[model samples]
Target: MAEQLAQLADDRALLGRTSTAERVSDILRSRISEGFFPPGTRLSEDSIGGALGVSRNTLREAFRLLTHERLLVHELNRGVFVRVLTVDDVEDIYRTRTLVECAVVRGLGEPPYALDALAGSVEEGRRGAREGDWKRVGTANIHFHRELVALAGSERTDEVMRSVFAELRLAFHVVDDWRALHEPYLARNHEILQALRAGDRDGAERLLAVYLANSQERLVEVYRRRVGEDG
Candidate 1:
């Protein structure tokens, strides 16, 4: 808890002054997505509130917001903890991803869309791969998809997927083989980026669809077995 508190202290500057629930929730959400608050980890309101220099009410509201996002859960007497996603949750998340991500690609009005962020995320994955940091690779992979979704230029869509992807990270934590989970996506991300750079929207969309489908299958299978073992 001390380490977590220290980390939150470092991030406190992000809140600036007059911390609102939205800003507090954003910090907590980013922390959860980064695996700082892994699944089933209980959140201490007092500790976190003190760490961020926010009031108890403000911190509770932030927890409430994240609960709505499926990143946190409140138990009657046990306090809030990061959520442990079920296999069905994993499947539903991917279904949502497939629908939104593919639609974003398909709805692209023209070629020569902004490709810089996408290219950067692809390169980020490669750098992580070379460094043997599979967790970093996974993060970069998520960034690649986030950038892909950004192509839609819809703030609403971005807001929705932010929660979805954070929820997806919970599923990712269940996997023991991070490399097996993230390594394959590096080349695939580059492939999609190349296609997009060449103005091959159809090809990019096709690649993204297949990529999401394959990822869903692999992740769901692992989740099922892991959940069963836990049960």
Candidate 2:
């Protein structure tokens, strides 16, 4: 009985540790998306661990997770840093998203689950936008599109789309005016949601394509201008 109780305690401890690591990862990822840790910003294990009241081991695990998501780069001997999104990265992600997302929509015939998920995300984004929470808005925006892509019913596509959005979040940080960059899209997202709800998959796909293309262009311009200013 004592042995069994000890084993249970060990399992609880492990679960608690894992939960802490996950929470650390989520907070760091959100900060990265919000531009708190811009491209090339080095993350010090000791400093970050201290700030978050986590152990160095936990912080390292969180860093590894973010690196896998492409939001951080782990350099040999140099340490981990926030990844800078190159123009090539932006273009490639946009192209891939367009292809996969459009295909997902095309194949989704009256997928109420997907439609409802998208709508829910859009409403959340609207609320976030109204509350002036650009970071939350950005997250909701990704969630909406991610749900739409999940309609493709391909686990592989979902994985690819997740990476694409991580990279896109880096690009979003380049915009100086966060609200300006995201506000205009809320209404467009609703339009897409309405079309999807109405079972107009083709129309939704077309609108999404245009919306993504325009968003890419705007983000690219913002990145260029910001880079120029920094230079």
Candidate 3:
């Protein structure tokens, strides 16, 4: 565990220059997304702080931020644990994505559509799938969506969408067929990107809406069972 934490601490070069608390939060957030801290896993401040070489106060602040983002939860007496999102949560997240992401594509203007981040993410997903790294593929998929949101040109929306994806990841962790679930989306993403590249905003938006709707439907059932929700 210490070794894994040490490696996580070392992977922050991509995180850029953030505050100490934010750096710790970013590491913890990445770990959560990677399934290092799976749903309901208790976050031991002592172990995490020691492993990351951070102070207690800073770790606590980081924990608070994640908690606020719905990635972590603070129980009355049980301490902090990774959040376990439910079916309703998944549905709500998809609904939010439809509103934000599809809206971006619908409102897109001009031809020089900045495709670097979006294209890069699709390629990343393809590489991850080739390597049998389903988790990496999943992360790249979220990155693709986040980049999609950026197309809307609103920083506030991007910030909100990030939290939405973090919560959605909790539900995704419950899926058993990771490869079967994520592999098909790689091509779907490329198709959407192609539609955009061809200057077909309506086509891209339509594909995105359908893509998100289908994904939400599939995840809803898994999450319902995972959270033991009654029919």
* Top-scoring candidate (TM-score): 1
True-vs-predicted CA distance for residue 193, candidate 3, Å: 0.7
Ranking by TM-score: 1, 3, 2
RMSD to true structure for each model, in Å: 1.5, 7.7, 2.4
| Model 1, span 10-122: residue lDDT tens | 98999997679999999988888888888999999889999999999999999999999999999999999999999889889999999999999889987788999999999
Question: What's the true lDDT of residue 158 in model 1?
Answer: 99
TM-score of each candidate structure, all chains considered together: 0.96, 0.79, 0.90
lDDT values, one for every candidate: 0.92, 0.78, 0.86
Report model 1's TM-score to 2 decimal places. 0.96
Tell me the tens digit of each residue's lDDT in model 3 across 21-94: 88888888878987888898888888877777778999999999999999999998889999988677788889
Candidate 1: clashing pairs of residues = none
Residue lDDT tens for model 2, 1-231 = 233233323433333545576777767776676566778888878666655557788888989888988899988999998998777677788898888888888887555644667778999999998899987887898898898887777898887777778778888876778788888889989998888877788888889999999988887778777766331
Candidate 1, residue 104: the lDDT equals 93
